[model samples]
Target: MKRLLSALLATAVLAGASLTARAETVDITMAAGHPPVFRWVKHANQTFIPAVNKALEGSGITVNWSEQYGGSIAKVGGVLEAVEEGLAEVGLVSSLFEAAKLAPQNVTYFTPFVSSNATAISELMDRLHEENAELRKSWEENNLEYLGAAIGIDDYLLMTTFPVNSLDDLKGKKIGAPGPAVNWLKGTGAIGVSGNLTTYYNEISTGVYDGVIVFATAAVPGKLYEVAPYVTKVGFGAQYAGGIAANKEWFDAQPEALQNALRRGGVAQREAYHKDLDQAITASLEAIRANGGTVTEVSPEFRMKWAAGMENVAKAWAAQLDGEGKPGSSVLSAYMDAMRKDGATPVRDWDKE
Candidate 1:
């Protein structure tokens, strides 16, 4: 029995030694074009990374995270290609920036004035992708595996150097909007110059553009009110234009445990993002006010007029998608129906006509 006890002690020592040694670690590189200032990247920093790390503890699995952000790996519009090309193993691909490639995934952006609750809009997107075959197909075709909703920003507002009391106030003004958002200005008579958050201040300050179609969450962080102090809350609807994605080939090769960890981390990131964003909206607006910026809301009458005046871009966009051999109308219908089911009353029924 003494010999048997000695052998058992030896085995125990070997197991302890194995435990003391560092576990095999998987290295994942997460990239985003935008800096951490934007909630898109901020959640990645605050939630995604830490959640995965904590979840994998003591599981014989560890991840070495290389965070490339603020244009470190790719520019704002280039994140999709970077992930596709394997430069980034995982990333937040900007659907808004890659609007042309992800056109069918942009149902909300097309149907503006839908709902102002950003979190609700994001949750609906999560449900659609899970329920719709074509939606999943669209992301698969891009060679990225969708992790979870990486919703960002908040309800869009009009920030201009001049106050806007009426639709006529926007006439002939060169306003900056990003990607597909340029269509939001149609029939409003605003010259929708393609622009993004990074340059809103400089562009508006230097007279390159009179104003920007921006979200309060970002406009305040960007200190846009300093340049364009007139903020008109038009409720152009909240948007979900990007999501956490993994390089398909790489993700498929990962162990199922790692894949699940990444997906769970993404979900945690989304929840933390909305919580952070909701709080930031009020705090940021207060800051904007303290900085001498004026905040005004467009009357319900004005909202109706704006919605009516704008051409039926949703249907037009759906037609364009159909021409491209996609189920744009179906996606539009699904999106609007989901919103209505959630008790949201949109000013215009984008899918009706």
Candidate 2:
């Protein structure tokens, strides 16, 4: 009987130790410049956070998440800085805002008219980060560890107060575009005004701009239809706006098991982001059309003409990077090559030019 009691006591003590070990928690703060309204933010909250928590379940480690979003911890365009400075252990870094800082990483932005598949674009971007050295360098230079990409908008669209039937409709018009995208307006005869989603509505409403080069996903919630209800589907191609990034020091400090959990969660988040983006693009465009808005699909011929008319921004973009010895040309060539291999026939091969 005494031996039985001793055995039971030992079992209870071991169980307590195991429970205590499993209760260990690691606290991490994740931040995003944009609010939780968009698909990227939504997936981060509903999918990614839950995914990580689930991955670590019964692994003797748990994460305490501090989610800061919607310009709460950092304003839009400042996520990279916040993460680099370790203000947030992880963040969603916007390449759109980091054009100058992450030039090579913005290959999708420079070479448009290639893809409209959000899933393909997101997966390709993640694969490129894994395979491309220069792409990896961009993150390392900024003291970030790339996890997976979060592509918000599916394809670029043009919204204007006036209906657009042809390229001539854009002549002498002042159209707003986000950073670096202003180059897309070159040779279109329309003056490109540097603008962001935040100011697109007010700018158009106040006559600060006549139209905007934007996306359907953003346009619907932005209530841009009230100001610029004319939506033109130009097939400007889906883009990589931002992605998950971690402070290098912080990431390296994590245990291997924790690192694996984060990586798994990041990939899951990317997939969720693309699926949601695909759904959002459809729903948002439908919402716009239902609200007395006009949706027009630009002809393939017109798209080709537009692509040809634009300043060989791709060539110049790559050359500028080549001059800086930043692997710009190589990334350009490789990206276009990959797209072609994936059965994409771009209106203009930005790299070959």
Candidate 3:
């Protein structure tokens, strides 16, 4: 009778252990390079995170977000590495900033004057990711999984101390441009200064640059009006969708249902981002004007000149990619074709055929 009781007790302990294991929870952490006050963070907090949590409400998996904005965990340029090293389970990566790391993806940004419409640009990026396996593999090799992409503000404009009515007006001026945007500043004779959206405010105020290449939405929030108050919408073209990527290892460890929830969150975040951007553009313009800034719409003639000047950057970028053994030329051609199909007439041939 005692022996039988021992056996039953052992079985009960085993059952309890199994139950504990089944009740274990999965947790995830996400990081963004922008500050909490920035639109990226605002949207994530107000829209993205809540939507994701709601999607995963009964999934038994919990996501704990760690917002390391303003260069806390990773600087704007270091976000890719941050995720690769597992500093955070997921992160916001600016393809425009990490052009070399995300080559084919950044092509959309290199080719300026392609399309200023946010919707078209977002669709193009999503299609590019879906159609190209290699592009997806690039993220995998870096220990990350690309979830969803979100478009930044519309094409960049020149925010300067002086009014820029023509391409000639940019001559000899020092303009702060992010990595790919430097290519857009070529032939205008403007001295291109490497800068990021994070540093633009202080740099502009300290006279580190005469102006900055930025979008109206960012300018208003960054309070760029106090420094370079003249806003010029030069129709430079829209930026490709930035992405939310996760550490592949961390992602794989999650339950299948939890993984699906994160993806659904990504989709919701992308839609919310675009919608917010559209609304922010109008509000930003008004806010900038209200804050004592000047906004100007560049003429079509000047827009054409600006577009023509930056045409060769696309070819140069393609060659740079070819040298890297990636399908840069092919990607550029495909993207140009897609853009044209979407009603964007290219100012220059991407293939030169």
Q: Write the per-residue lDDT of candidate 2 for residues 56-160, one digit (tens) a residue.
A: 887878888999998898987889999999999988888888887788878888888988876777787789889987898988998999888556458899999
Count of clashes, each model: 0, 0, 0
Ranked by lDDT from best down, the candidates are 1, 2, 3
Q: Give the alpha carbon lDDT tens digit for every residue of 1-353 in model 3.
A: 99999999999999998865654454456677788777766777777777878887776656666666667888887888999999988788877778768878887777777777876778677767877887887788889888875555577788999988777788999999988788888888999998888899888888889999988888887889999989998887778747888899888877787778777777787788888888888888899999999989988887777777664877878898899888788888888888888899655555563
Q: TM-score for model 2?
A: 0.92
Q: Worst ten-residue run, lDDT, model 2? A: 18-27
Considering lDDT, which of the candidate structures 2 and 3 is the better prediction for this target? Answer: 2
- Return whichever of 1 and 2 wins on TM-score: 1
lDDT of 1 by residue, 1-353 (tens): 99999999999999988764644678789999989998879889889999888878767788889999999999898998899889989999888888778887788888888888988888788778878888877778888888885585589999999999999999999999988889889889889999899889899999999999999888877999999999999889888788889989888987777888898898898888898888888888888899999999999998888888888888999999989998889899998999999989988998997
The local distance difference test score of each candidate is 0.87, 0.86, 0.80
TM-score of each: 0.92, 0.92, 0.91
Least well predicted 10-residue stretch by lDDT in candidate 1: 18-27
